[model samples]
Target: MAFQSIKHFALELDGPDDIVYSSGEMVTGVVILELTREIKVRSLRVLGRGVAIAHWLENRSVGVNTVYNDYTSKTIYFRKRQHLIRDNGDLTVIPAGRHEYPFSFQLPEETLVTSFEGKHGSIRYWVKVKLHRPWATVKKIKKEFTVIEPIDINTPSLLAPQAGTKDKMARIWYRNCGQVSITAKIDRKGYTPGEVIPVFAEFDNSTSRSVVPKAYITQTQTFIARGTMKQKRAVVATLCGDIVGPRRRETWHGRAIKIPPVGPSILQCRIIKVEYMLRVCVDVPGTSKLSLELPLVMGTIPLHPFGSRTSSVSSQYSVNMEWLRMAIPEQPEPPPDYSSVVTEEEAAQNSTAVQPEEDLSGVLQPSLLAYIQEFRSRPPPVYSEVDPNPQPITMRRRCMTC
Candidate 1:
């Protein structure tokens, strides 16, 4: 075996485990070095870098031959370098046993994208330490950390309710069958993981074929390279209602779709973007689906306190950023495309609960009276629903560890 003097070379971050760094946050860490003998060092340096990059290859058949083209683009958000040991012409000898070099960096005050690993692109932040010796090879160690740029959901714009309506006409053999229309609304557009999103929607089917009403949370990832762009979408969570007979109507009164653990929306990046959409759809038997999409922004912080919650229910839930560290145990493949087909395994995991109807006619229920007693601490959510003719909807949630 070859001789080596260094026993350990690692970078350790400070703060609580699974702590997510944010903009304008202080990042403190230590570079540890353990050596068995005296080591001569020219200079030791630390570098912090964050960037978004996209690269993909496409094939084109030129007559009988296939040609491959490469597309690449990169945007640097921040770069910082500091010398732990300054060099001055001559080599600096470092007598080694175990050395710990402490370092601190202040993230930029400007907006920074959250840490993400996508299909064709990614936004990443990391700290790298390099050791330079007179005659020995340069030793490099890298450690990646999660950065979740704070987006408060309590802002006026994100707090205002969002609603939309869409209509589609069905056709068969160049003949008009009928029309299907759907209206969907949400209390707000911003939310954090573990919070519940009350989806209020109405579906009307005038068509001859039966239609099923469904709602889902979808994630869209966009990557741009050399002016060319690639996009991938996946359904992260979903809930379904009973079928609406032809020429019938179905309504969703504050249906709950809990936002699963996921990375925040990444919009400040140049080459990559992560966006979410809540879609309420009607599946037509033989034609395209009629869908209504509402934009959604996931955040790192919850709304106001747990008392005055007319829009969000779980105001007690704080930031859950574990997906950042647990998401990518290794390189991640792109999420699957959005599909309505529920396999047996997925159906087995469906949550079907009968929610109690709210006393919207100014009647205070016993549950609210009990909930108001303790304002200091918030209780866990009662997986509930509403309707006089209560139709329990089946919900399927797909969480992105990334």
Candidate 2:
């Protein structure tokens, strides 16, 4: 109804149905403009850009007085434009017919933050087309694309396994009430989404009260704005309530927690960060929770083949220059905070298989493995509260068909 002269404006990518790309890959697409009637236009252009945005409200209390403050930040990583009709003179008329404009762009080789849609933030790449007319308001169209950076588990740091042990003594005044100790280890520190993380836990509880042990995977996202940093955390997956009776020593040889297809670790990204932690928690009545956390790195690809990887540093200068050319007057914004990077339905299908292994059998006999396996397969424990803060508004993109 807004524009009678235009029929349908469609954008199509030259790839499979899913519009996904890796770092340094070329993105080629076409903008099809079907017009019902002849129209006049000043120029036509296509723009490609990537941006990270974070916005949230913080609450604080001071001496019975409560106050709320709003915080917002945005960062533009790259912005590039290609004019399809730059040289054409003024008042150019596009005849009524099917018209197609082809466009191509190469993503920077430097490691880019993975595409994510979070509760308070987002890292997104999009292609936009504009039909500029002197007699009418500008008509624009936008399409979103996904970008993933390859993560190799075969890297030396990730290849070496990780382990840690901790001991905590509960004290009341000067008297020791109880002591709890745990040893935890993982097969690998780096993993891809859908891989099962086997956590081997040994608990020694020397106390009067019973301790409930729980294991879960946590996702932490840190956003940096200017110099200040804000973080949001969520327990994406979990297994809990395996009782460790008083004065008992229990060993869990195989507790598998599947990694959802979420964004990989984003340490190199300046504004946004995505990191996972395998947590072992023991809840004690009338006492602080005792826990151990181990870092987990997620990537798009696993390092089975151990192929050589290309250097992203080669395009660092070009990326900086591109940012300068965009000339955004405001400060750069940090990446977004994701709420559910992987949907529940999607997560169910992409879980790691609970396969029996001979190597694991050596550590703990079939009895212990079966016990832990049954516990792990049970439904995940319910979380009383994910976060206390108000839910952030979910972002909605303008219709790409418009």
Candidate 3:
């Protein structure tokens, strides 16, 4: 038999969760090589590689009337290799037995820390082991791993829950209607996977038209290339909606939207940026829809004191009542008063009739000016209206018999 000695080849990680890792952490694993009998090997090598690749297809106009499909691809990567056994001068022979070679590598400190797999692109990390032979294709084994960075939620701004409400009047479009207002609030603005987001909403449809409010969370990614920027948004999750009666208002409280396992916000990456937002909108037929948006921060860790509670029983409880405060109705601004503002016609008439400055010999006298200046320089007035000035009081008592 040509290849009777080589029995088995495998790779195993030291950690229990072999696929999970953090930046700058040491990764240790073992390469197992089992042989049926004595065998000769040239060398054994291990390599680690991290790469981000983006590829897509689009249609392009070729000539005056012809169109063609084109494909585009871009990649950024890093690779490290180490030799466990090198064939310096002579080949090494091993007796028939189970052999294990341990290897370790330290990931770069300042590197892309999150692993992402998406439809159009991917950020991947893997470790590969190869057994080199003279003139034969090298036998290889590869394993994928996930890398994540710590996103602390203890920051003062992130610790507080986020809520906002907006109201708008549709008089320009819906002239016969009054106003339509939508208020939406979330328990907190920052969250991680496995955490539930509590959403509370209220809608007031003062217009004559019926309104249906819809709310959803959208994840947007911005890709920058060659001085050009492109953006793509995908709906990650959705909340329930309610139909509001015409000229009526309704309130909804404590609707939970679970966050799925998705990549966190990627602000550290230069070419790629990820952001999430909560959008609340009302669909109005034959008119423009009213909508409100709130920025959401997706981190690697959920709010502290409650971590990884997706399977916990207490997560089913309603969020604090404070989250509902965002549903407060919008107050209309006071209408402008024409009396305080001079109109164009009135200004023109006054300008035409106004005379030159009149002589004020009596009012602008030296004595009068001096008196006014003296009065102005004097301290503020002090009145004896309370304790210093006493008022006479009369007291009367009713007898118990009466």
**TM-score: model 1 vs. ground truth:** 0.75
Q: Order the candidates by lDDT, highest first — what do you get?
A: 1, 2, 3
Output the number of the TM-score-best candidate.
Answer: 1
lDDT of 2 at 143: 86
- Candidate 1 Cα outliers beyond 4 Å, as residue runs: 1-3, 306-402
Q: Note the residue pairs that clash in candidate 3.
A: none
Q: Point to the candidate with the largest lDDT.
A: 1
Q: What tens digits encode model 2's per-residue C-alpha lDDT throughout 45-128?
A: 989998888666768898899998776678776787889877376677888899999999888777666676555567889999
Would you list the clashing residue pairs of candidate 1?
355-384, 355-385
Where does candidate 2 have its weakest 10-residue lDDT segment? 383-392
lDDT of model 1, residue 248: 91
Which residues of candidate 2, in runs, are more than 4 Å off? 58-70, 87-89, 171-174, 303-402
Across 1-402, the per-residue lDDT of candidate 3 in tens digits comes to 426777988988775532455567677899999999887779999999887654444455667665643333444555888888887867788789899999999887775546655434556788999997665678899987766555554455655555667776655443545677777766556776545666667788887777877666655555554444444444555555567888989776665565444456666655555677777777554445566787777665445453423422224345564653443223312211211122233334445222222221211123322222222222222100110000100111111121
**How big is the RMSD of model 3?**
28.1
Per-model TM-score, in order, reads 0.75, 0.71, 0.66
Task: Please state the error at residue 220 of candidate 2 in Å.
Answer: 1.4
